[model samples]
Target chain A: MSINRNENSKLDFLLEIGNIGSGNALTSLAEFIDRRVDMKAPRLEFVDFNELFGSVGGVENVVSGFLINVHGDVNGIMLFLLQNELASEVCDILLGSKLIDLNALDELHVSLFKEIANIMAGSYISALAEMTGLKITTSVPDLAIDMAGAILSVPLIHFENVFGQILLIQNSFSVDLKEYNSSIFFFLEDESIAKLMKQFGIE
Target chain B: MGKKILIVDDAAFMRMMIKNGLTQNGFTDIFEAGDGQQALDMYQAERPDLVFMDITMPNVDGIQALKNIKAFDPAAKVVMCSAMGQEAMVVEAIESGALDFIVKPFKIDRVLQTVSKVLG
Candidate 1:
């Protein structure tokens, strides 16, 4: 049973998984920060690299990004992006003081953000792994505080040989009362997509 | 409440949080390591009563450190700590001689409870 990637059913299935993963990640983040982390429905987009960067307020948008290379049954790159101000706000909550600037985040601040990304992405990846009965793990994660375009190019370039269009799951979340937008891009190899679809009996 | 404990994590913030919790609960003989290599070295050097080690880290990870510590002393009481989605690694840790597992974003009470049970 070969699954058609463009089929509406396939899109719906991936979106559902995205929703579940984001929900679990949000719950974990809320607990970690002790704040009300609310989320909007997850959106799944299969778009060109240029359009992908545009989705996150264009590639020039200055943001904090965390990149993790996912391994095991699911082979892909997982990226978490956060607005600079929102990154600082979360750091403030974690550090119990004001984070002067995201651009000037010191070693401690970098470690804190990396840990937060670990909790969030780990929870989300765990949900997917549990649901599919696949063994999944992530690298230690690399952080980039730069323009969205510059940060996103890392994953896009890494998966360039495997994918023409990337699967992006956009999540909108708010911490405390400040609205923040974040995105998670899952660059699954073709075989990985097939494996996931087969797990759900879609193929 | 004099049980010596070691906290291993790459994040200074995480180590500080766990240390603060353990200290507030009266567990004073505590040590910290930034990565698994440090964890293994510190475990042999400090001989802490119990260790709370995060699973993912640079250079060496928690599971490897657990294996190293156990090989040195099978009677070592070690607990693996990780984020929500690391069940596979958690199982591996337990199989490798870890006494328990703790998830991140953990409450202070949970950390204390695990310490009490493991040290007891």
Candidate 2:
């Protein structure tokens, strides 16, 4: 589906906002983990279910997931992904345990990821709120452990190809003296992007 | 101003890490609890001057635990130990009567600063 000129502009605006939000999250991760996190802000896009599911290697091994559902004048979903290994590292860092078993993926691990997702998503949402002058309230992030494909199979009722790109954030963080890599996918709707641009006073 | 502080978290390593940081900064009377219920029990017996509570746990999560503790002592000085992405819960905890919060993967300086700031 092709988005109109106004929608296209909005997409760009939202993508930029996502980048700033993700950047702030990365900085906090770096401070907590004491490691540098590398991120790439690709153009946002709208993908068919098949293509979207295929992009993240089928999401079959996804150990833990966090979702920040956005509701407002505009809407979309912000997803944080951590393969089992990375998820464990995050747990270890927050809990200060080098002996934590990555394979366990226990309750503490899930809870820790939920908190991390909250921070990352909250930072992003706060930035959006400041720029748009709108109060964005995010639901308690829903936590899931499923195959990547299964998770992707869940439909996004409000999907839009705002920027014609996907903001893929790659993070390398360490905890318990171990290092791991993870990524976050942010899908922005075209209308949301437009609202963001107007809020930022971007031409 | 010397005050007793309680540290509640399931992870022994984390409790030790925070204990080490706090004690080094002259917080001599420190107590440890593995979960929220344990924290409440300790709070009743110890009447600690402050608390460092973790948000997630098996028996009772941090936020609920915070509320329970606050119900007993509205003047409870609890500092939440949060991980990333827990901003909403942190806000809730603060509203629920926590004095402040500290993010996990505890930074030595930040922990000390927060502890001193809150305790003072």
Candidate 3:
């Protein structure tokens, strides 16, 4: 099953999986909201660490995220982030109710948010695993309801010592026939990339 | 008590979510475990009518736990919770005698449907 891959070819392969994953995510989200969900083509980018904060509002912007650890033939962290309002909107639809203001994240909010991220990422990676013909698996997600910078900082450890740009998929999701747009992000390491290719005898 | 159910996952939050979903559907006779080791022990202690087991975990994972439980009690009704829709893994679980599987980010109705079909 090995296919020869240059750096560009490798990323192309991964991005293909990203496309499938994002499509799965959008479908799952559409089902959850019981509304139409649309997504623009996911963009692959390499952003500087310091400037990464600006892509999603900023480091100080309040956000909610789901953190998943990829295991097996490939190993890295996959993250899904959404703006605060959209996250709450999703929760409202999922629970079939709206809640009043809350400056703090309570147990219930975190739980619902985690499940949303769980299904989204679970479907994403599951599709990726199927596409790659590798034994890729994911652990239970860890959630963060905090400032964007704070959330990104924790996973930064997984990226430590690696210089240059951080690679990611920037996906835009439009939910429920509304023009309101949201986002989901993913991060996989170069080592994982190599491992995945190696499994298919692509050394 | 109603039909006893056991949920096995590494995350307390997920365990709570599934439990809440089950309770909302009037299936509240439930027990929880953090990982496969605890799940196996609880399976013996609780002898739940059916089990919902997550595939990935810190300690003894779901596959090993499923094997252990099936080995211990051949009649154990076990269903796997798979994060990825991996064909090989699904095949392995089925080979290990899993009754069925449900993917994560579950809809409550889907969960209940799986439960009822398995219980029947």
Best lDDT among the predictions, by candidate number: 1
Which lDDT tens digits does candidate 3 get at residues A120-177?
Answer: 7777777877766877777767877778778888767656555333556677767765
Question: Can you list the residue pairs that collide in candidate 1?
Answer: A59-A149
What's the true lDDT of residue B52 in model 1?
A: 91
Error of 3 at A138 (Å): 1.3
Q: What is the TM-score of each candidate against the true structure?
A: 0.94, 0.65, 0.82
Which regions of candidate 3 deviate over 4 angstroms?
Answer: A1-6, A48-51, A96-103, A162-165, A179-185, A195-203, B9-28, B57-60, B105-109
The full ranking of all candidates by TM-score, starting with the best, is 1, 3, 2
Tell me how each candidate scores on DockQ against the true complex: 0.72, 0.17, 0.47
Native contact fraction (fnat) of model 1? 0.69
Q: Which ten residues in a row have the lowest lDDT in candidate 2 chain A?
A: A155-164
Candidate 2 lDDT, tens digit per residue, B8-117? Answer: 97666567668888877777899999888999999989999888888656577677888999999988888887553344555677789988777654578877787768
User: How displaced is residue A149 in candidate 1, in Å?
Assistant: 0.8
Q: Please report how far candidate 1 places residue A161 from its true position, in Å.
A: 1.3
CAPRI quality level assigned to candidate 3 from its DockQ score: acceptable
